[model samples]
Every structure is written in structure tokens, then in C-alpha cells.
Target: MLAKRIIPCLDVKDGRVVKGKQFIHLRDAGDPVELAMFYNEEGADELVFLDISASSEGRNTMVNVVRSVASQLNIPFTVGGGIHSLENIKALLRAGADKVSLNSSAVKTPELITAGSDFFGRQCIVCAIDAKFDKDSGFYRVYIHGGQKRTEWDAIEWAKKAVSLGAGEILLTSMDRDGEKNGFELNLTRKISESVDVPVIASGGAGKLSDFSDVFIRGEADAALAASVFHYKETSVKQVKAYLKQEGVAIR
Candidate 1:
């Protein structure tokens, strides 16, 4: 069996790592480069860097910071935010990104997924979806631009479409649970994981070590991505891995 991946996410803004609830009221977490190198040495399965404000600000990725972070890591890392075209994807890969994640760009032009997959292969493209619950519909609604805009897209349906369009993996974040440190939105995670054949990365709401195990064993996520819990030293990657192993979840 393929061991489940444990990923540390660096949500960046202005060249520094930051975190917030529902993607607002941002607070500084740490320096991206320093945190990334630490995670790399600490047995992180993979690393993800997201220029959290690029799309909303209507600009390109912060390349300098990405280059700095990528240069120090031997582990594979994925870059996202404001990736809108093949050119942008190529630029990021050239700067050392192992994979490129697409969110609002894919929603506006899904053909980008095919283009990216054609140019770089499906495994090189990760489809990131930020979703929130809709009480009226009793279903999750997909959001974009750092959860600032709502689309008509159903979260589950979008996951299926992304896979069909050649997305190799799904990075699903539940806005409702994000930064609350409660626990993962297991039902939403399971829904997308079951709906798609590719890997699904569960993000948001991981408070304790058990949260990680719960998401993998119960939520069925291929990987668990968290920020604050790891950033603030509330938990360590090594500790989380030990707990997951004890709980019978496969890990590297």
C-alpha cells in the first residue's frame, strides 16, 4: 500500500507565512523559508506553498519567495495561487515547483487543466477547491479567490469534473472548519474522496493528533494538510506520524 502523505502548508502573503480563519484576519505565522526547511528535515512527506492573496489581488505568484523556499528543500513541493496559464505553470516549475495547483483559474477556464495536463501531465496539476456549507442546500458550496467569491459549482460535482479534466489530485479545504482547530470536515472529505479516483488532500480544522488520524482512517483522505497546529508547535510532524502509525494508518 502507498503510505499516506503528511504535508505542511505555507500560506504566504508578502513573502511571509500567515494563517487565518475563513481566509480573513490574517496573522503572521513564521518565515516561509525557515519553516519549510524545518519541515523538510522533520520528515514531511511533501510541502505546499500557496500565495494566498495573489488571485484576489489580481497578480502573479511571488516568485522570489517561491524560489527561495524551493531552493532549500530536497522534498517535492507544490505551488499554487494566481496560476492562470501554461506560461505561469511553466515559470513556477522552472523555479522548482514539483506541481502546480489551480483554483479560480481552473474555474474560469477549465481548459487550463487539460492544457496543463497535456503539457506537464496530469500528475503535475493539483485542483484546489475551497468549499463552505450552505444551510439552505445542505451541501457544500465551492468558493474561489481566497474564499471571497461563491460559485454555482457544487463541491462534489466540481471534484468529479476536475478529475475528468486531468487533475491528478484534489486539495479540498473546508472554509467552515479552517483555522478553527476543531477537526476536519470528515463528511466533506469522504464525499470528495469517494467521488474522485485521484488522491484527495484534506485541509482545515485539524486541532489535535487524533484529528489527523481521524481524517485518514475515517475521512479517507490520501493526505492531511495543516498549518497552525504545526506552525505554532502545538504538534510536531514526527509526533503526528507516530500517532498515525499507532492508530494503524499507513505512513512513510
Candidate 2:
């Protein structure tokens, strides 16, 4: 069996890493390059840098930041946000991102997924879904533009469609559970995990060590990504990996 991965996320807005609760009330985390280096030494399986700014200026700013962060890490690195075209993916990949994550742009132009995979291989593309449970529809609804807009697609269907279009991984985040510090949205994670063949990285709602174990075993997630828990000195990646090892969860 492939070992479960533990990843630290850097949500960059203006060339600086930031974190927030449920996608609002943002606060500073730290320098993306500094955090990247710390996590690399701290035993993190991978690092994810998200350009949450999603602006033309921000995208350019992120390229330089990604290059700097990439230089400091020996582990796999993934970058997301403001990725709309094949050229955008190319820029980040050239800047040393192991993979490129897509959300808003993919929703606007589904072909980008196929194009990205065709040019860079499916492994280079990650489809990130920010989902919120819809009581009326009884399904997890996909949110785009940083959870500010709701799409007509259901989270499960979108995951399937993205995989079909050549996305090799699904980055699933529950908007309601984001920064809630409870646990992952198991149902949402499992549904997408089961629906698609690609690896699913469960995001949001990770409050404690047990949450990681639970997401791996119960949610059936291939990996777990967290931000605040790792930032602010709440828990180190080495500590989480040790706990997972003690709990009998395979780790790298």
C-alpha cells in the first residue's frame, strides 16, 4: 500500500503565506520560503503553496515566491490559484512546482485540465474542490472564486469529471469545516475518494492528531493537508508523523 502523506499548506496572498477561518478573516502565517524550509526539515511529506490572491499581479508575484520556496525544499511541492491557462501551468512548473492545482479556472474552462495533463502529464494536475454541504440538494456543492461563488456542479460529480479530464489528484476541502478545528468531512472526502481513481488529498477541519488518523482510515483519503495546525507552532510535522506511526498509520 502507498503510505499516507502529510502536507503543509502555504496560502499566499501577496507573496506572503496567510491562513484564515472558513476562507475569511485572514491573518499572517509566515514567509512562504521560511515555512517551506522548516517543513522540509520537520519531516513533511510534501508542501503546497496556494496563490490565494488570484490576480495577474499576484500570479507573477507567486512565480518568484514559488521559485524561492522550491529552492528551499527537498520534498514535493504543489502550487495553486490564478491558474487559468496552459501557460499559467507552464510558468509554475518551470518555477519548480511539482504539480499545479486548479479550481476557478477549471470550472470556467474544463479543457484546461486535459490540456495540462496532455502537456505535463496527469500527475502534474491537481483538481481542488472547495465544497459546502447543501441541505436542499443533499449533496456537497462546489464553491469557486475562493468559496465566494457556488457552481452548479456537485462535488462528487466534479471530481469524477476532473479525473476524466486528466486531473491525477483531487484536493478536497470542506468550506464549512475549513479552519473549524474539528475533523475532516469524512462523507465528502469518501464520496470523492470512492468516485475517482486519482489520489484524494483531504483538506480542512483537522484539529488534532486523531483527525489525521481518522481521515486516513475513515475518510479513506490518500493524504491530509493542514495549515494552522502546522503554523503558529501548534504541532510540528514530525510530531504528527510520529503520532501517526504510533497509531499504526503508514507514513513516508
Candidate 3:
């Protein structure tokens, strides 16, 4: 069995790391480069840097920030937000990102996924889906443009479509649970994980250490990504890994 990965996320805005509750009322956390280096040394399995406002602001990702954070990390780094074209993905790859996450652009122009995978290989492309429960549809609906807009696509259907279009992995985030310390959306995570063949990274709603184990085991997530808990120092990567190992969860 592959070891479950514990990833630390850097939700950056204006070059600084930030966190918020349910993707609102944003607040500063720290510097992106500093946090990257800290997590690299702190035994994090991987690092994810998201330019949280780039798409909504109608701009490209902050390549400068990507370069700065990339310089400090030896582990795999994934960068996303405001990436619209192949050139944008190329620029980020040259700037040092191992993988480029496609969200808004993927929803707007899905062929980009097949194009990126064809040119750069599927492993270099990740499909990030931000979703929340829809009362009218009675299903999770995909959100885009930094969770500011909703699409008609159902979350489960989109995950399968993204994988079929050549996405190497799925980065699934629960907008309803984002930045909340309660727990991850197990039902959503499990549905996506079971629906996609690619590895699924369960994101959002991670509070206590037990939440990690719960998602990995019950949700069947291949990886778990968290920001607030690690950013606030409520728990460290090493501490979480240790706790997971003790809980009989295979972790790296």
C-alpha cells in the first residue's frame, strides 16, 4: 500500500500566506517562503501554494512567489490559481513548480487538461475542484474563480471527467469546510476518491489529529491537505505524522 501523504497548504494573497473561515474573512498567516522552508524541514510530505485571489483578480499566478518558495523546498511542490493557458503552466514549471493545478481554467476550458498532459505528461497536471452542497440540486456543485462563482457541473461527475481528460490527480476541497477546524467532508471525499482512479488529495475542514486518520481511513483519501492548523502552530507536520503512525495509518 502507498503511504498516505500529509501536505501543508499555503493559501497566499499579495505574496503573504493567509487563511480564512469557509473561504471568507481572510486573515494573514505568515510569509510563503518562510512557511515553505519550515514545512520542508518539519517533515511535511509535500507543499501546495495557492495564489488564492489571482483568478478573481483577473491575473496570472504570482510566479515570483512561486520562485521564492520553490527555492526553499526540496520536496514536491504544487502551484495553482489564475493559471489559464499552457504558457502559464510552462512559466510556473520553469519557475520551479512540480505540478500546476487547474481549477477555473479547467472548468472554463477543459481541453487544457488534455493539452497539458499531452505536452508535459499527466503527472504535471492536477485538477482542483472546489465544491459546496447545493440545496436546489441536492448535490455538491463545483465552484470556480476562487469559490466566488458556481458552475452547473456536479462535483462527482466533474472529478471523473477530469481524470478522463488526463488529470494526474484530484485536489478536492470542500468550500463549506474550508478553514473550519471541525473535520473534513468524508462523504464528499470518499465519493470523489472512489470515483477517480488518480490519487485524491482531500482538502479543507481539518481540525484535530483524529481528523487526518478519519479521512484517510473512512474517506479513503490518498492524501490530506491542511492550512490553518499547521499555520497557527496548533499542530506540526511531525506531530501529525507521529500521531497517524500510532493510529496504524501508513504515512510517509
Best by lDDT: 2
Model 3 stretches with alpha carbons more than 4 Å out:
19-30, 53-61
Ranked by lDDT from best down, the candidates are: 2, 3, 1
Lowest summed lDDT over 10 consecutive residues: which window, candidate 2?
Answer: 20-29
Q: Per-residue CA lDDT of candidate 3, range 98-216, in tens?
A: 99999999999999999999989999999999999998889999999889998999999999999999999999999999988889999999999998899999999999999999999
Considering summed lDDT, which 10 consecutive residues are worst modelled in model 1?
20-29
Evaluate model 2: give its lDDT.
Answer: 0.89
lDDT of 1 by residue, 1-252 (tens): 899999988878766677533222223335667777778777899999888664533234367777877888788899988888899888888888889999999999999999999998899999999999999988899999889999999999999999999999999999999999999999999999999999999999989999999999889999999888877778889999999999999899
TM-score of candidate 1 versus the correct structure, residues matched by position: 0.90
lDDT of 2 by residue, 157-239 (tens): 99999999999999999999998999999988988899899999999998888999999999999999999887755777898
Greater TM-score among 1 and 2 belongs to 2
Q: List lDDT for all candidates, in order.
A: 0.87, 0.89, 0.88
Model 2 error, position 99 (Å): 0.3
| Candidate 2 clashing pairs, residues 3+ apart or interchain | none
